[model samples]
Target: MKFFKTSLLLFSTLLILFSCRTEEIQIIDPPIENELAANSTVAKLMKNTVAKDGSKDNIIDKASCLSVKLPVTVTVNSKEITVNDEDGYEEIEDIFDLFDNDVDAIVISYPIEVILSDYTVKTVNSDEELQRLAENCTGENEADDDIECLDFYYPLKASVFNANLELILTITIEDDEQMHKLIEDLEDYSAVTIEFPFKVILNGDTYVYINNMQELEEALEAAKNSCDEDDDNDYNDDDCDKCSTEGIKKIFANCNEWSVEKLYLNEEYLTEEFKMFTFSFRENGSIKIDNNGDISEGIWEITGEGNEMSFSINIPDYPAFNGTWYLHEVKEDSGEVSVHLLLEGNHLRFKSQCSTVKDGLNAILLAEGSIWAVESYKNTGEDETAVFADYQIYFYSENVVKAKKDGAVIEGVWESLNDGSMLALNFSDEPVNAFNKEWEVAVMSETEVVLEANDKRLVIKRIN
Candidate 1:
């Protein structure tokens, strides 16, 4: 009687599990066909990455391997770049292939720096190069789908050059400890990341599948619209309201550091970096204050809502921080955005962060790797390119700049000024051209950077 009861109970449990899992746990449903819209690399990976055996297979493992689609963001140098781009394949190296699925996407953030060396850096930016790197994987271990991988290949390559425009090492110093170890033995500047994204499967119904950015966006749009919604439903008032002033608090709450710029108090101005203050707000309602070498942690909150709000800083040692801060303004233009605060009784109108680490790296990258010639210069309301067009400007390591014209090379120091909105150059002997002073960068792109000063405009370009 005991043996018969145990068998009956086991049979009942198996039937229940099969019925429950038959329900499609789909966040998305691709065409019900064998054809998968994957790149050659992803297709091969998917073909070999078998799904886990559920209760039906009677080989159930006590692990869940499911793939769900969601928005993935990558913040590089304080700029949130929606990672719409995908690179080469990564070697599969899981001892048991954690979930029976191939890695369709990976999000990595690394500290970006340039290594200046004498040898040229050969970076991969194409599909062919990726295949070459895959062939060079070291471990040759047993990976999922019978696909073996031993390493990763990052897409972007950062290199530094010397004044004479010489290739340095491809990799350099890394801030993140894990990334440091990964590339410490290799050559190049390194990027940093603390943790990988972790997720848990809700049930056995979840299984990894092939998907891409376009499909993910479509799913988000569908969720937003709810095309099959009933006409009797009502929308929530809070969902359609204009953005509240309290929203600024959440922006600061992110991990990025905000620099104090454009400080004013009681009609008197002060250094933007006065007191050498740097603010780091955490996502958990905690904030950090760093001045020179002194650092402290405390909690912060915003009390007001809508168009009016006040910032409250709670730190025991810092009594000067006790003040009601007003929302002076919020500005977004030309791909740059920032927040400002005003203390009514105090002479303070403080601007928040606008520059990013990527911005600095971009300026450096563009300034180097090119021999810029003057395409147009309008100073004193005259086209002066005819005269300065012969000048070739070269940016190099250590903020050094060299302008070569008429067999004479004048060396100067170039730096990013005014919250990275301006490029300033101070030469040992200032040139007579219009670009020899502080220039408000009106345009910065991969091909060119436009500068304006005193109602005058300058265009520098790389034609090669």
Candidate 2:
């Protein structure tokens, strides 16, 4: 009986050892690539997305891979200025514009701090030290490590799991810094699965939905070097990164009564002739032009994609405006929409007067007790602003204008024509008569109204 009991005990121990080995095999069976391993390609791409972008401050430092810390003192064109923030860069630009003939230079004060691409901050005591650091950066507009065309949407939840696929903990990633740290802290025995159906923005305007890790990886790889990073020191060179064909189509189809605000053909301005016409674009690729009760029909189409979009219009009556013009920019400011098109030396801008924008401008113009003073005026390319220095103009809701000077008032009939694109004034008085005619509303705001005619420009500012 003792020998039989020993044999049974040994068999039971072997059974237990076999069970332990099976479980160990299961734990180590998961492939490292399936998890958020430290050396995984996905992890590396995520790190690149979160890496610090020092090119934003290239305007001040003239370095693409480094940024000067804020509140640094610098001499801009012999004028000492303290750059407190990004707005200070514009101030420096203004100083640089003060004189165009002179050489522009910026001298940085010593002992200033700079941030590297990896977000490392270091203090440089002299110009030589800063130059040495800048020498390590990529050349202007050259290829760089950081991916500028793609960005992950924030507040993403990551589901963490152990090697056995058991839920460990969930992490919330808010911004780039949090994401960077999360990817950096990934362990070999753990897996991080980003919750599916997350969004990423491409070129700051296009939205892409990612369903799984594979899609995310593919998107990151595709967008790594898909655009111009704008790493050059020319801050004013606006890249149309956000411009897309679909966006331009939506803007054109949605808004009616688009008037030509500016039109140039081979360096000749032709805006005055098109002032009387209003354009309407249809989604079915049809266009209608209304010229003071006269209607003309045409077909329009947009070709290409993204920033390479081109607009082609064939208006049989107006051949000058017909061309496959490159879409330069589409901008909206304070309810106003403007589309800029360029081809060779030709430039055209279409300003839309949507109902909301027109109503807003009319409200500002007809506001009770509002008075506008002539800030500047030009007649036939000659400055005649001083003639109306004492005049204060008022607009009534009933399309009546009254110019008061020295307690004497001159009545004039006024109208907002071309869907608020033009301001027509019929003042018979001598000084204010110079403002008569259909003036294009080049700019309209709460505090100012700028009108332009053929060789005549007028600027009026609101006083009260």
Candidate 3:
């Protein structure tokens, strides 16, 4: 009986000990594949996207893969000048443009520093050193490894986590250099998570929102080689980099008139023939071509976006001017705006005068009781001032023009054209038939108007 009692006590003690023992816990970690690997394709693409674009200073170095540090002195055509920044490149171009017949050359003041494709700065002590470095670069306009079509908006936040999924560091990247360093310093064992909701710019203008890593990788891959990087020695090649279809359309619609400043069709210069033509673009996709008082209708549209945009015009009557022209550059200088278009060997330039100047000229011509008398007149180098010595010309606000001498009156129509750069006079009177021509306004004011046509000149002074 004592043996049985002892056995029961042992069994109960064993049960209690087994029940009090701790459970064996397996600490399974989260999958490492869920984290971004430093050597992944997306990380490599990001590094390439942020790589230094040395082609921006190609004008100075003539090397598309490296750039000379600025504030360097250069002898352009024997004229010494310090190029402080990118704007100083224009100064070098101006020197070269001073004489087209001379051999244009630029000599960089040596011991100048150069930045390479990897963002490494090197000292170039002589022309030989620069040439050696330049020889390592890709040929002009050739393909390079750097991705220029995609750019990330900075101040990007990224969190670095250790192997245990504990946050080791959080960094704010401010620029391309900072982002490049971050990608270069990443370790395979560590994971980095980019904060969501950032912006990326494609081809310099298209903005895209990136919500996650997958979207960012896809965007960067798609943007690769999407457009021309303008990796060339020509500084003016990328002048329209910031141009957009909507912006070009706005420029066309806002301008009152555009005159043909230059026109080349298949290597033939036709600028003179179209000088009197003025173009007006409406928001409804209709275009008007006004040559003096004769008007023609056409359909116009801008297609594509960003720098790849094209301007297409279809004028049934004007076949020579109908084509889908590539929008090259839109330049605004002083008070004039110029839109340059190109197609193969053909080129076209449209210029517009300032609106303020056009308005001032219109106000002077439509003034109340304005009587203009002939001050001088020359027809084909022959003095013809006596032909209208007794005539007094009257300009009406309704575009009616009348010239009265003794008792006879000559009726004519006058209109201000070419953004006030020209005056068109249409007269059926036999006595003043010579005046029925589009006259280029050489000078205009409240008191005097000077007109020129071929070799003929006419000057009229406001007498009232």
Clashes of each: 16, 0, 0
Candidate 2 C-alpha lDDT tens digits along 121-160 = 9998998888899999888888777888898887787654
Q: Model 1, which residues run further than 4 Å from truth?
A: 1-277, 280-288, 291-294, 297-351, 357-368, 430-434
TM agreement with the true structure for every prediction = 0.30, 0.47, 0.49
- Per residue, candidate 1 scores C-alpha lDDT tens digits across 105-135 of 2323332211111111234344354335334
Which candidate number has the best TM-score? 3
In order, what is each prediction's RMSD in angstroms? 26.4, 25.2, 27.8
List the global CA lDDT of all models. Answer: 0.42, 0.75, 0.75
Q: How does candidate 1 score on lDDT?
A: 0.42
Pick by lDDT: 1 or 3, better one: 3
Better of 1 and 3 by TM-score: 3
- Relative to the true structure, candidate 3 reaches a TM of 0.49
lDDT of 3 by residue, 19-66 (tens): 221133223332443345567898888888988888767778888788
Candidate 3 ranges beyond 4 A from true positions: 1-35, 236-464
lDDT of 1 at 345: 35
Model 2: residues with Cα > 4 Å off, grouped in runs: 1-34, 162-166, 187-189, 239-464
